[model samples]
Target: MRNLLMKVSYDGTDYNGFQTQPGGHTIQDYLEEAIRRLSGEQLKITASGRTDAGVHARAQVFNFYTASPIPVERWCMALNTWLPEDIVVSDAMEVPMEFHSRHAAKRKTYRFTINANQYPDLFNRRYQIHHHGKLDIAAMRQGLSHLIGTHDFTTFASRKSTKPSHVRTIFDAWIEKDTSTCRPGTRDQGIIHTFISGNGFLQHMVRIIMGTLIEVGEGKRQPDDMKVILEAQNRAAAGPTAMGKGLMLWEVDYDIASQEKHND
Candidate 1:
C-alpha cells in the first residue's frame, strides 16, 4: 500500500458539509465515491479537518492509503474526471505512510469575508455575507489583536463542541479591506476580509470570533472588552456565530522538511 496526499478545493454552497452523513450529500461522500469508481476499491481518506456546511475551502489536504498502481502525478486528472466541477483535486503526491493529514497538520488559516455593501453583489452573494453601515475597522483590529496569543478559547467555541480542551494558540489574525471589485461613488464600498491562523480550532470558533469582532466594529463592545471576554472562559461572553458561508478554509500547513516522498 502507498500513501497519497491530495490538495482539494471546493465550493460548499450545495453540500451539507465536508463530512459524510446518512443520506446527506457531502464533499467526502463525493470524493470517496469518485475514488471507488476510479480505483475499484473502497478507501477511507483522512482530511486535515472538516468544514461546516456552506464553508468553502481553497487548499484542504487529505491523505489516503491505496494499493492501486495509478501514477501520483495523474491522480489529479484522474480524480477530476469523476468528481464534480465544484470539487477539484488540484495536486497529488506520494508520501511516506507515516504522514497523516489531520494529525500532521501544523497550522490552519481561515478567512471570513463580509461584504460591507448596502446592496449585495449579485455574482458573489453565495460566498460572502452582506452587512450594512460602515464598520470601525480600527476597533475591529484592536479587538482581533487580543486573540493573537495562546488562550482558553471557550468563549469562542460552540457549546456543542465536546473537545476536552478549549486552549488553542493563534499565531496571527488580521483584517483587510478588499476593494478590488468596488467602484467609487457606488453603494458598495468594499469587502472586509478577516484572516486567522492557528494551531487548531474548535467548532465554530472562527465564526464566533468574527461575530465578536463585528460587534466591536459596530461599537456594541469596546475593543478592550475582548480581553475581558477571553478571560471569562464562558461561551456566553462571545457574540453570535457568524454565518458559515462567509468563512473559508484558506489553507493548511505541514512542515515540508519533515515530509518523505515515496519512490516512484
Candidate 2:
C-alpha cells in the first residue's frame, strides 16, 4: 500500500462538517465514497483537522493509504468524477508511509470574513458574517498585536474541545479592509477579512479570536483587554464565538522551506 496526500477545496455550506458523524452528511463521507467508487477499495482517509459546519476551505489537506495503481495526478480527475461539485481534489501526490496529514502540518492559516455594509445581503449570508456598523480597524489591529506571539489560547478555544494542551504559537495576525475581490455571485462590495496564521489551532480558536476582535472594533472592549483575556484563560472572559460560516481554512503548510502557490 502507498500513502497519498491530496489538497481539496470545498464549499461547506451544506455539509454537516469535515468529519464523519452519525446521521449527518460530511466531507469525509463523500471523499471516501468517491474513492471507493473509483478504486473499489475501502479505505479510511485522514484530514489535517476537522472544520466546523458551514466553515469553508480553500486548501484542506488529507491523506489515505491506497493500493490502487493509478497515477497520482490522475486521482484528482478520477475522484472529481464521483465526488460532488462542491468538493474537488485540487492536487494529489504520493508520500512515504510514515507521512501523516495532521501530524505533518507545519502551519495553518484561517480567514474570517465580515461584511461591513448596512444593507441586508441574502447572497453572501452563507459565506460571510454581515455586520452593519462601522468597525474601528485601528482598534482591531491593536487587539491583533496581542495575539501574534506564542501564548496559552485556552480562552479562545471552545469548551467542548478535548485537546490536551491549549498552548499554541501565533506567527501572524492581521485584518484586511475593503477587499472587493471574491468568488463570483457571492462577493459583497465591502468586506473585511481577518487572517490568522499559526503552528496550530484549537477548536473554535479562530472564531473566538474574531469574536474578541469584533468587540474591540465595536468599542465594547479595549484593545488592551486581549492580554487580559489570554491571561485569564477563561472562555467566558473572551467575547462570543463568531459564526462558523464566516470562517475559512485559507491555507495549509507541510514543507515550510518550499511554500505553495497560495499566499496569506
Candidate 3:
C-alpha cells in the first residue's frame, strides 16, 4: 500500500464539521465517499485535526493509504469531480508509508474574524460574528501578548476537555484590521482579524482566547488581566467562548520550516 496526502479546502457553512458523524453530512464523509468510488475500496482517512461545525478550512491536510495505482497528481481532479463544490481536494501527493497526518503536523494556525459593523450584514451572517463597537486593537494586542511562549492553557480550553497536558507554546499572535472583504454592501470599516499560531491547541482554546481578547478590546477587562487569567489554570477565569462560526482552521504545518510560509 502507498500513502497519499491531500490538501483540501471546504466551505464549512453547510456541513456539520470536518469529521464524520452518524448522519455523515460532514466534509470527511463526502471525501471518503468520493475516494471509495474511485478506488472501489473503503478508506479511512486521517486529518490534521478536527474542526468544529461552521468552521472553515483553507488548507486542511489529510492522508490515507491506498493500493490503487491512480496517479497522485490526478487525484485532486478526480476527487473534485466526485466531491461537492464546497469540498475540493486542491492537491494530492504520494508520501512515505509511515507518514501520519495528525501526528506529523508541527504547528497549527487558527484565525478568528469579527465584524464590528454596527449595521446588520445579511451577506456575511453565516460566517462572521457581528460585534457592534469600535474594538481597541492595542488593548487586544496587549491581552494576546501574555499568551505567547510556553504555558498551561487550561484556562482557555473547554472544561470538558480532559487532555492531561494543557501546556503549549504559542509562537506568535497578532491582530489585523479589515484583513478580508465581504460582498457588496457589506460594511467595510469594522473587520477585525486575530491570528494565533501554536504547537497545538486544546478544544475551544482559540475561541476562548479570542473572546477574552475581545473583552479587553471592549474595556470590560484590562489587558494585564490576561496574565492573571492565564495563571488561574481554570476555565471559568477566562472570558466567554466565542462563536464557532467566526473561527476558521486557516492552516496546518507539518514541519517547523513550513510554519510561517503562509504568513501573507
Candidate 4:
C-alpha cells in the first residue's frame, strides 16, 4: 500500500466541519468517498486537525493509504469531479507509509477577518464578522503585542475544549488592514484583518484573542491586562470568543524535504 497526501481547501459555509459526522456533510466525507470511488479502496484519511463549523481552510492537509496505481496529478482532478463545489483538492501525491499529516505538521497559521464598518456587505457577510463600532487599532495592536510568546492559553480556549495541554508557543500575532481592494465582487470597504501565526493553537484560541483585542479597542480592557489574563489561566478572565465564521486555517507548515518526499 502507498500513502497519498492531499492539500485540501474549502469554503466552510455549508458543511458541519472538517471531520465527518452521521447524517452530515463534511470535508473528510467527500474526500474519502472520492478516493473510494476512484480506487475502490477503503482508505481512512487523517487530517492535521479539525476546524469548527463555519471555519474555512485555504490549505488544510490530509493523508490516506491506497493500493491503486493512479498518478499523483490525477488525484486532484478525479476528486474534484466527485467533491462539492465548495471543497477542492488542490494538490496530491504519494507519500511514505509512515508519514501522518497530523503528526508531521510543524506549525499552523489561522486568520480571522473583521468587517469594521457601519453596514455589512451582503456578499462577504458569510465570511467575515461585522462590527459597526469604530475600533482603536493602536489599542488592539498593544494587546496583540502582549500575546507574542509562550503561555498557558487556558483562558483563551473554549470551555468545551478537550485538549490535554493548554501550553502553546505563539511566535507572532498582529492586526493589519485589508489593502487588497482590487477584488471584483468583494466589498473593499472598511475591513480589518487579523493575521496570527503560531506554533500551535488551543481550541478557539485565535477567536478569544481577537475578542480580547476587540475589547481593548473599545476601551473595556487595557492592553497591559492581557498579561493578567494569561497569568490567571482562567477561562472567565478572557474576553468573549469571536464568531467561528470569520476564522480560516490559512496555512500548514512542515519540513520541506519531508513534505516533498511525501508528495513524491
Index of the highest-lDDT prediction: 1
State in Å the error of residue 109, model 1.
Answer: 0.2
The C-alpha RMSD of each candidate to the native structure, in angstroms, is 1.8, 4.8, 4.5, 3.4
lDDT of 4 by residue, 48-140 (tens): 888988899999999987778888888899888988888999988776778888888888889899887667768988889988777788888
- What are the runs in model 3 whose C-alpha is more than 4 Å off? 179-189, 256-264
| Candidate 1 residue-wise lDDT, 48-110, digit = tens | 999999999999999999999998988899999999999999989878888889999999999
What local lDDT score does residue 166 receive in model 3, on the 0 to 100 scale? 97
Cα-based lDDT at residue 40, candidate 3: 95
TM-score of each: 0.96, 0.92, 0.91, 0.92
Instruction: Report the C-alpha displacement of residue 187, candidate 1, in angstroms.
Output: 6.1
Error of 4 at 59 (Å): 0.5
> 1 or 4: which has the higher lDDT?
1
Answer with 2 or 4, whichever has the higher lDDT: 2
- lDDT per residue, candidate 3, 1-264, as tens digits? 888889998889888899989977999999999999999979889999988788888899999999999988889998899998888799887766677889988888998888887664688777778887767889899989999999999999998998899999999999888734544675445678899999889988999998888899899999999999999998999999998889888889876234334332
List lDDT for all candidates, in order: 0.92, 0.89, 0.87, 0.85
TM-score of 3: 0.91
Worst 10 residues of 2 by lDDT: 255-264
